[model samples]
Target: MLIRYTPGRTGLAEGLRRAARAVLYLPTACRLARDPGYPWLNAGAVRWLDRHLAPAMVGFEWGAGRSTLFFAARVARLTTIEHKEKWRRRVAHLLARRGVGNVTLRFVPPSDDPGRPGLRPALWRELGYEPHKPEFAAYADVILDIAEASLDFVCIDGRARVACSLNSLPLLRPGGFLVLDNSEWEKYAPIFTAAAGWPRLDFENGVWRTTILRRPGGANG
Candidate 1:
């Protein structure tokens, strides 16, 4: 599916404000880049997850990084999907070195064909992480192997996030959380529309927003 970004909401003021915030965040971003175990989420979101995530819960995340170690430490088990080969190997080393046994890391590279089904080129360009081009339909679809409503939480911080978010909703147990990092982007508008009734909480920061949406209804519903 070709998911187009809606640029309508991000006017000149929003652009300028984000640019200013990006400048302000440079120091902190630099520090975070050096720390491999620190999740790239806004600090408020990290605190929220620290408070809410249980030791017995199972979680899945798109884009593996320091967050892999973070979630693996907190949750009973974590399944992480990554598209980069070298990065995946590095994270795997980190997991082994740290003795984090709860994570199952999978490397699902971008599709060789840009015209492959469900590929979203526009969304990928907006993400701007194209070391190998933005064909992550298969990467996002990796979650489909897990049974529906089985996940306690799903985090979308990687490529093809809109598609990942769409794929994640049904996989979450009711009241389960869907965490979206960099939620301030206009390209992710579809998730809000698709998750219309879900209760959402935003951990807002000047540079980026981390959003959490709880699936509504009973646990089995």
Candidate 2:
């Protein structure tokens, strides 16, 4: 396993570890730079998703990008929530040009709200993300409108992912999967803790990590 970075604890050994990990991921980074259409996740996670996701499955994602395009082709229907208008439009154009018809893209931008519930203040401070961005609370809540335990898959790869994952936990049907990219970050520790009983698989490529959790017998999504 690659060593996780810890602030204020790095020394010569940690620096060397970082360099080694970067070298290990060089080829993957090069290939991804050349082909941006692929989901920007750990290769193993992508492979697992390819093997597991079925054409009849219904899905939702918190980010709209290559993943949106990738899932649009594989799933029966997909709903993507994007925070940036420009990127969402760009993805929409790609979908139109590629003749992908199964995706419903929704744009939800950040806004200031005083009372919107989300990640705790300490967690936000630790993550270096703005605590005042209340739009993510609403963005995550978009899935609430769908019937509980109806969705087959949910992927959280965008902003406020912690909030998204927590909100999404109840919407996943039993045996459904929840994919969370960038799972190595310390800020995301809460998700693993909150999803205590989920059967989890973690794919790591030294640089990037993705965690897939199977919703076993529990609450409906």
What's the lDDT for residue 149 in model 1? 85
Candidate 1 runs further than 4 Å off = 1-19, 30-35, 112-134, 218-221
Candidate 2 C-alpha lDDT tens digits along 15-90 = 9877887797887788688876678878899889998888999999999998987788789999999989999999
- Model 2 is weakest, by summed lDDT over 10 consecutive residues, at 114-123
Candidate 1 residue-wise lDDT, 1-221, digit = tens: 11123356587776776567667577568858887777888787888888888899999999899788889988999999888999999999989999989999998888754433343334334444233334766777677677888999999999988878877788889879999998887888877877888888897656568899998976522
**TM per prediction:** 0.78, 0.82
Whole-model lDDT, candidate 2? Answer: 0.80
Candidate 1 accuracy as TM-score: 0.78
10, model 2: CA deviation in Å? 11
